[model samples]
Target: MASQRGRLTMGLVLILLAMTALAGRALQLQAIEAPAYASSAASKIQRAYTLHPDRGQIVDRNGTVLAASEPAVLIFADPLMISRNGIDERVSMGPLETQKAAAAPKAIAKILAKHLGGRPEDYRQMVTKTESDGSLARYALVRRHVPSYTYDLIKKDLAAGKWYGISATQDAVRSYPSGTVASNVIGFVNSEGQGGAGLEYALNKQLAGTEGKESYEASTYGRIPLGRATLAPAVNGTYYTLTLDATMQLTTQKALASAVASTGAESGEAIVMNVKTGEVLAMASMPTYDSSNLSAATSNEMVNHAIQDSYEPGSVQKVLTMAALTDQGLVTPDSRVDVPASISSGGGTIKDAFSHGSLALTARGVIAYSSNIGTTLLTRKMDKATFIKYLKSFGLGATTGIGLPGEAKGSVPTASMPDFTRDQISFGQGLSVTAIQEAAAVAGIVNGGVYHSPTIIKSARNGQGEAVKVPVSTSRRVISAKASAEVRNMMEAVVTLEPSRAVAGYRTIGKTGTAQRIDPSCHCYRGYTASYVGIGPAENPSILTYVVLNNPVKGHEGSGVALPVAQQILSVALPRYGVEPSTSKPPKAVLEYQP
Candidate 1:
């Protein structure tokens, strides 16, 4: 009886011990491992995705769109998700099913080719590609930047055919609506949807905007209904309003291209500025490619020549020299000066463009006739320090403060410059200046001596479409108003020299430049650079037009080649901008002094 009781006690002890162990295990699981298991479960079902924001739209001042982005899709494939053998999770299939599974890649390729416009064999290769480890590739890019409607068609085909593993994601594509108009300024977007050049490159951070992300619960088929989801909405890029007139830009481009073609020039560049505001109304560059078709562009064609390139501006430099001399009380427009047929300077003979005897000429006559020796003689009277100070104030030996990528800050001579070099520069040689710099300097000289830094951005809007305040351009006084007026009047004589240069009912003032081209490869003079800069309504100049032609094979003279282009640009720009006609004829100057 005692043995039987001990047996029962042992059985009861064993039962109690088993019960205690079960209770301990339940507590451990509920308290310690519960959070970890829950987290793992959530991780298995949760999916996160990047949300790309729409890129900004670049528009003209008049709301004309230049560049924009459109919605698209990236079609891709998961070869690993597709079954190569007729086995479902290690379960073998029948012979018929196996045969069908083996033929799936070819059949899938056929359906893809029907919509994507590629050979079935190519698609099959993409779908059947393997990794270096001899395993099926996990992911493969089928096509990117596919139109939404086209992808919808592809999706419909995929659903009807019950094709698996192929999928698509959202994307965007940058587009240029105006094609080549202001292309060099607007620049082009690279394949990665990033700005490649010009303003697009300079302001990329502001224009690209910020990306966002979203997390949600998903299943094998699709998103789970009533699933836990969190979204961080994307912020679209800023909307830029450039100070460009699209119509005027197109006009300038066409005129410049025509001039370049007719003159057999290597390339051409032009810039039109609003004198009162210093806004670049139109900037054009020739040998330019279509902004929409960048694949056909050459490296040279992509250059923004107006600001990127610099050259010796020939007689155009005379305007600045004459202005400096007049401002310093060194000479007057009517001051008499004896100009010989030729003068020896630095072991080189200097003469006017046209041969002449030892004729007497007024200071204004030197500019009117573009006499090289006469300009040299006049430059000899001015001190180098004062002349260089005036040039620097006029935006030389420095950038014009025009916000552009790859702008050239042209070189200038210092106070200790050689006399020969000074003589050469007095007539627009021995120094370099860009088209933008020269244009802005001349505008400053005529705009009551105020030098307003040039600007291309007129305004901007934030992602939410709220108007953002754009910083106004910096301005400073460069010369006296009296001196500026004198220079303006002196330039009128240049216009009077050519009857055809006068616009009907509009008084014009300008300077022509024809400097030898400096070859970059050899650093030697190769051909000639023809350029012209002009302002309209001489009494109150409003618009400034500048044109440049590089290495013209047919004609190398600024008057014959570049002046016509400048004239064409001004004729259109003046009328388009509502610039008033001249109120009175300019006072005729005494070009020659009588004995």
Candidate 2:
């Protein structure tokens, strides 16, 4: 009887121990591990995706679109979905078994290839792709920026329940309606819809809007209908209104292209600036490729030559030299100087374009005739320190601050420069300058001496059409107003000397330049750069046009190759912008002085 009681006690004790262990396990599960398990379950049911915002439109001052973003879709593949469906396993079994694995993938790839312009094999490879770790890839990009209409057709097939891993999301593709027009300035976009060059790349941050996030409850298949969700709305990019006039830009490009072709020139650049406002109405680079078809473009053709290329301005730079001399009272338009056929400086003989005996000519006559010897003789009167200072004040040795990518700051001769180098720079040989820099410097000389920094962007607005303030271009005085007027008068004499430069019904003034081109291959001068910089209605200069042709085999003179292009642009731009023709002719310049 005692043994039976002890066995009963042992059985009670065992039952109590078992109850305590069960209670402990329940507490641990309910208190310690419950949150982690709950989180794991939630993760399986919730998902988040990025919502891309619309990129901005780049438009001209008059609201003409230059670069725009069009609606499209990004097609993607979920290889993990293919793996989950057992197609991956079948694909590993060599097309023998029912060929079901190869069949599904082939069908999907074929459909994708038909809609998109890719090979079926390529798509199939992506669909069956694996990760770097030897596991099936969860995601793969089939194509980006696919046309929306094309995506629609693919979606129809997907809705038919055939396509398993194929999917698409709304996206954008950049479009250039003007084709190659202003391509060098507007730039192009890459396949990923990112700015690849020019203004597009420089202002990419403002052009590319902010992306947002969207999270929602999703099952193994897809997002649940009316499931719990959270969203952060995206902000679209700002619309940039540039100072470029689309019409003028097209006209300038056509003229420049024709000149380049007719002259058999390597390449060319042109810029039209508003003398008063410093607005760049047109900036054209020739041999430009269509931004829409970037693969066909060469690296040389993609350059923004107006701002990127720095070359010897030849005589076009003489405008600044003459302006500086006039401002310093070192020379006057009517002052007379006896010019020789050739003058020796730093072991180099500087000669005029035409060989002539000693002749007496006024300062205005020296500029109009483009006498190199005469210019050098006059430049020698100024000290090196003063001359270099004047060059800097005219916006040389620095960038024009036009706010474009890859802009070059053309170098200027300094106080330490050799005497011969200084003399060469006086007539635009030793110095290097960009087309835009030259244009702006001339504008400063003719625009009452106030140097306005060049600018392409005029205004900016948000996606909601609200104006965003853009900093105004900086301006400073570079010369006296009287000096500017005198220089304008002197340039007017140049047009008088060459009737070909004169635009009918308007009094024009400009200088022609022919400088030996520097070849990068040898770092030596090989060819000539013919250029012309002109301003119209000389009494009150309104517009300045600068054109330069590189290595023209035929008609290598500036007047022959570059002047016609400048005239063509001015003929349209001046009237188009409503700068009235001159009612009275400019004062007659006394070219020669009789002793």
Candidate 3:
């Protein structure tokens, strides 16, 4: 009996000890580990990190701000939070709470209508519509971009602090100050901050800054403490300072616009370059777009015609021929040739604009009169190999190396051509080139026979006004200094001699070209490509301008239409650049007749 009672007491003690251990474990879980586990659960419900991006700014060479970033707001909604009361079976609302449920849709509609000032019917319709998932009795907006003013109104009138559904977030947006001026070059951005065209597309990586990350802990009530977050501040993007002078760009654009409008031409392009440096001072193309509103213009209007389009350069190619002849020591300003009415070559005959009866003409006279027959005769004196070499050296049959996108290389005959092909190319036919290539060629002629690669960007800058110079290649002397001068002098005579191509008292040198357009149907001439290229201050020659009119209706000759426009642009542009007018006598015509 004693052994039995001892065993029973020990078993009772073991049971009490086991119960105590169980009770202690329950207290420990409720008191010590609960808060930690709750925190871990909360972390899963809320995302820990958010990214912030630094916006870029754009300024002109003069430091005028063209584009910058402005703070904005985004609005969102949670339908689950708003509709929970209507479908809950475990909890029942009292009379007042039940009354709130019936009126919730109307109340939300009223608030949205009052703040956003839209039709109440639209809001009511949005709230009452059934979602694909029948579980969601209320509507939830996936995302919405709202302006700052509308956000302010929502915060003031809706009392969103007490409501559980509405959410407001902050963001950055791009803003332009100069409106449509230089819009084509400045370009624009999409909502995601991606650049679309022009400088925006060219320097996107530099302009787009690194994104930063943010993390925070939120309470069950969705309130976040200020000190409990980890943040890495974003680094701002670098600023771009272009070489474009806003004033000069505007002036050029206006002139081109006027020319396009008055002449009723389909499109127009104008560019101004500093003769000393290859810095493009001003570049403008008509049918431009507003960077702020890209959709406002058609795709055709957005093209940068000066760099993208190429056509037969017509008489402008004569500048290259003049350079080739003089540089090879085969000709001089006074070198004379017997210019005939026309000459037969290979399988075709080359003709002049007008018949010349075996007239004796100097090398300079041929250029001044722009005779196809005379230029062809001059090319024959020089063999095909030497001609092709000089043409390539002048940057023909190749790209201008301008960094702009969609630039055409401009076509030139690759191999040794037949007599007809050589004759046509000598007179600026059977070849195609861009306006920029023509301008660069002219720069080679007047800028001491050196060719400098053209560029639109001037320099890049930061916020402190400190600048980094853009890399530029040194100018290469493509022809001798003496040859360049001889060509320059002859070109000057074209503008100054008899009935002067340009206006008097301007001291400008130029060449007129009228090339027949190739017709697709008959493979013969149907229209004309008229163009004029000129340089000012005939003695020093500071500015060079090239203008081309494609298929003009009334007068399709360069002298008739293109020369006057070139003269007007140079007249204003020269004085603007501080180039002094020349007081020297105009070039006198040199003439001789043959029977």
The TM-score between candidate 2 and the true structure equals: 0.92
Tens-place lDDT per residue, model 2, 1-595, is 9999999999999999999999898888899989998788777667666677788999998999999989988788877665443343324454443454446677778888888877888788888889889876756888888889998898797667555677777778889998988899989878667789998898888888888888898654777898889998778898999999999999999999999999999899999999999999999998898999998999989999999998999998889999999999998899888998788989978988888999899989999999888888889999989999998998988988888999999998779999999899999998899998899999999999999999999999986789998757889999999999989988999899877779988999999999999888999999999999989889889999999999999998898899889988898888989999889977988999997
What lDDT tens digits, residue by residue, belong to model 3 across residues 537-580?
Answer: 77777888777776677677888777877777777778888887
- In the range 208-260, model 1's lDDT, one tens digit per residue, is 88888888996545579999999987788888999999999999999999999
* Root mean square deviation (Cα) for candidate 1: 3.4
What TM-score goes with each of the models? Answer: 0.91, 0.92, 0.83
lDDT value for model 1 = 0.86
Q: State the C-alpha lDDT per candidate.
A: 0.86, 0.87, 0.73
1 or 2, greater by lDDT:
2
Q: What's the ranking of the predictions by lDDT, best on top?
A: 2, 1, 3
Better of 1 and 3 by lDDT: 1
In model 2, which residue pairs have backbone atoms overlapping below 3 Å? none
Q: Which model scores highest in lDDT?
A: 2
Model 2 alpha-carbon drift over 4 Å, by segment = 1-23, 83-106, 125-139, 464-466
